[model samples]
Target chain A: MTQRLKTPLKEDDISSLKAGDEIILSGIIYGARDAAHKRIIESINSNQKLPFELKGSVIFYVGPSPVPPGRKSGAVGPTTSARMDSLTEPLLKKGLMGIIGKGDRNNHLRKLMQKYKCIYFIAPGGISAFLASKIKDIKEIAYNDLGPEAVFEIEVKDFPLFVAYDIQGNNIFELALRRE
Target chain B: MKIIKITKIKNQIKKLIKTASFNLPEDITDSIRQACSAEKNNTAKKILELILKNSEIAAKKKIPLCQDCGNVYIDIKIGENICIEKFSFLQDMADEAVAEAYKENYLRKSIVSDPLFDRINTKDNTPAYLSIVPADTLDGLEINVFLKGGGSENCSFLYMLTPSDSADAIISKVLDAVRQNVTKSCPPVIIGIGIGATSSKVTELARKAAFRNLKIRNADDKYKILENSILEKINNTGIGPAGLGGMTTALAVNIEYMPCHMATLPVAVSFACHSLRRASSKILLP
Candidate 1:
């Protein structure tokens, strides 16, 4: 029998997600990629408050295309999560519960996720159109000059994703790719 | 000879970029449809269906086929007899086209100014990887544009093998490379193999091989035969869609070959993920 997660996940709720589990994530997710991550980390190191609280938050590693006429954003899809590995530990320490991105995370990051009870979810790469449908709205929160790389608070409802890395440090990518 | 205005060429290139990004090319879509029907595993079949559906959504709604619109690669084959007033100004015109397309079309500006340090976004996707080839004919130009996404591009590998390396060894190395890099490169990949060439030529041939429509067969009989065999072996790995473990890990394997030094066997593997956004145009300059 398959397990279904309750919607609007809390910090403790992250523990329920496991590698290979399918999830329909709802609520708020902040968008950040490389440039935005560096800024966020700088703010953290400087003992300044982050633009949004990290507690129970899910950060999507995406740099979206510009919004077309009559659209909120264009072609928003997960980028490689491993690019953000350097910035993840601090954010996880601050109570980030989940990350949504494509590709693998390193073992050290997986260990941090385990220690912090966070989950790493993957949306289908290159399925930008499908992924964009799940996004309800987006509001630029900071670094507006960064264009597509700006930080935005995104609202989503039932955004489908699969858990690639779970709270127990199990990585579905590693498990699935291991040579028999 | 009438001189073609740089601005006019720029506009056409911009339109091409937008059209190529918004529309999933028919050949690639058809290939996915065939792969979906032929895929044996239930899970892999479902994933292929989703990919097809995603392509539909991208076309109907005019969304970018993928978030990574990729660095613009424009291969220009200029006619031998055609004359340009300012021959060297072509690159500037192409850069302007890239900027306009990336901005006006809502495409992501993915290019960076420097590779090692100060990794700053160029804001507009300028500095296209432009290659100029002299055309054999007298009256027309041919332009081939490919939006090469980094995910699949990163998975590419080059191997310098001894002449003694058997077909089996080549196949094994290619499979192992894909298997090792599966999660990193988005799955349901199209593998392009270039065999029997110098290192640089192998790399070029691998990319050229990837641009061949999945439905087409290599004219060379040996290469066509090897393409099918390699495709079968890759799918047999069961990496599946998105590396979730299924039978349809590879959609196709296209191979291009060139004569190499007798003692050296260079093989290059290039990967194209499911999106595969590429197109070509031929312009008649009368």
Candidate 2:
């Protein structure tokens, strides 16, 4: 059975999530990929305030297709998360609670996720249209110059993902490897 | 000798790009369906099923298969007897076709004007990498267009093996590359293994091999056997669909080889996710 969780993902919510658990994530989330992450980290290094708050919130690593005539998002799907690994540390340090993307994470970063009581979720890569259908709305929150890589506030309903890393640093990747 | 109008080439390219962006080629779709049935893990099976459904929706609704839509890569082979009429620059025409098609199809503009210094969206994906191959034959143009997503392309690798390296060393290297990077790209991946060439040519061969149709086998029987073996070993890694764990880590392994110097045995590996998008067509010159 899958777990249905909403936004404002608190510490308890993240702690309760186990690696390999399927989840239906709803409510507000922020979407940013490599370019936006770089800019955000630059801003952070400059000691400027972040555009979006991280506390109890979710970050989706995605660069969606252009919004078609009547759609909230176009073919939105997870990107390979490891690309943002270097920039991700600062964000996690600032109370970023959850991340939704695809593929594996570095071991050191998983430890940082645990230190911050955050979780990493994996959405199946390449099924963008199906994933897009679950999103209800999208608003560009920052870095509009980056276009698709810009930070956007997306409201989703029943967005499906797998909890690949939880607060305890139990990684589904390692578990899967061990099973093999 | 015959000629084809520039506008005809432009329109043909535009239509081909639109088709490739939204649809998986028939061979890849069929392969995915077969993988779904063969997948024992329930999660991986579901992921495979979703992939099939996504392709159907992408085609019917006219939405892109993936947001990345990728860098448009075109390979054109023009017969010497065939001439391009009205305009002569194939590269410019390829860019024009790409710009129009991306705008019309709602495909994401993934290209940056500059790789660094000042990164700006080109707005329309322009400047596709077009390689025009020369041939002396009938008056026809053969074009193959590909849309490879960024995630998988970033994981591609090239290695130059020493002359004395044994087959076991080559096998171990292939396996290591798969284990280290397979999860980074979306899987049941289609892997292209290019062997027996200098450094530069082997990478291109690998990129070409990865997108080659699953139904097409390496002509050499030995390479065909090696391809099957590599596929089996990759699946054994159990990276599964999207690396969640299962038996379908790679749907197929395509190999292409070239004759190279005795001292250099370069190998290149490129991966394409399940959204293997490619389209090909022939245009008869006027």
Candidate 3:
């Protein structure tokens, strides 16, 4: 069943989600990747204000292709989530409620999600053309030097995603592993 | 000896790059169709359907098949009787094509100028990685172009086995790797298993095999059988399309082997995700 949800979700909203539930997300979100993650961590360590507020925010790990003329974005698919695992818990602790990417993260990431009342969503990889149309508005937020890796504030409508990790630590990927 | 113009080759490169991004080869599309029909898992079937739809949209609009257009690799096979004219250095011409295509085609520029530090975007996707080979008794130049994303490249592995190891042992290692790391790359993968060579060359062969058309299998009958076996085992793991769980974790397995020393057996596994982007062209001369 396809469930529709608004972004900048609160704890209760994320807690209601369960692994394997499909969703269509609407509202504003942030797009970021490797370089942006590192910069965020550095900002936190140096005791500087984050460029964007993390509370009630969803971080999408995507370094989208350059937006072609007449289109909102180029192929904007999810990157591998595991690559950002090491730098993720801090964001979750800072009230980051959701993450959207592909692939399985580690037990530690699962535990963090459980502790923080967060959810991990898996956007299908390599389906950018369909997903790109969902973006209604966009602006470069930070790390312009990083180009595609730079952060972008984006508003989306009916963006397709599936719940991979839920608040209670259940992971859809782990469930897939067990159905032997 | 016959002559071919460098400008002609550059023009072909531009077309190859655009075609590789816009239109996935028919064999890969057919393989996806076969997997979708064979998949019993509902989630995997849906994922495969979405992938097919994405490709259809990309073809109609001339958009890139994936956002991560990936690093460009050019494999050139030149004939002994072919005389190249116009450009002094072929790599420069190929790089020019890459730059031009990425800009004009609206493809992503994903190349980093440096590896460890100072990770700057190259702006245009220049300095295409090249692999050149010389051919005998051929009359034209052939070029194979492919795009590889970091997600799939991260799952690639290389192993140096002792001479005494059996085929089953190698297969076991590959299965173990797939079970652990296949999700990182998009699933319904085409695995490239290269056996017998130095560490680097073995990996190279694996990459080459991964980019080859799904219609082509290993020439040797023994390797072909092993390829089938590996494909079956990987599918049984239940990774499925997009790793959502199903009977189609891997669509195909291609094994490439070479003659190596008696003391060592090197094996490399390079798998292509569902969007295995590649194209080829030939420059004929008179």
Against the true two-chain complex, what DockQ does each candidate achieve?
A: 0.55, 0.83, 0.76
**Candidate 3 segments exceeding 4 Å error:** none
Chain A only: TM-score of every candidate? 0.91, 0.95, 0.95
Output the lDDT of residue A88, model 1: 88
- The TM-score values for the models, in the order shown, are 0.92, 0.97, 0.98
How would you encode candidate 2's per-residue C-alpha lDDT over B73-176 as one tens digit per residue? 99888887877775458788889999989988889888889898888988888889988788778469888899888899998888898878866676788789
In candidate 1, stretches whose alpha carbon ends up further than 4 angstroms from where it belongs are: A1-8, A174-180, B1-5, B40-42, B137-139
Model 3 interface CAPRI class: medium
Write candidate 1's Cα lDDT for A1-180 as tens digits: 134444345755766667888777778889998889888889999999888988878899888877688986688888877778888888988888878888776778888888988888888788887777877898889988777788988888778788888877788766664531
* Number of the top TM-score candidate: 3
| Tens digits of lDDT, candidate 2, A20-61 | 999999999999998899888898899998878878889999
* Clash count, candidate 3: 0
> Between candidates 1 and 2, which one is better according to TM-score?
2
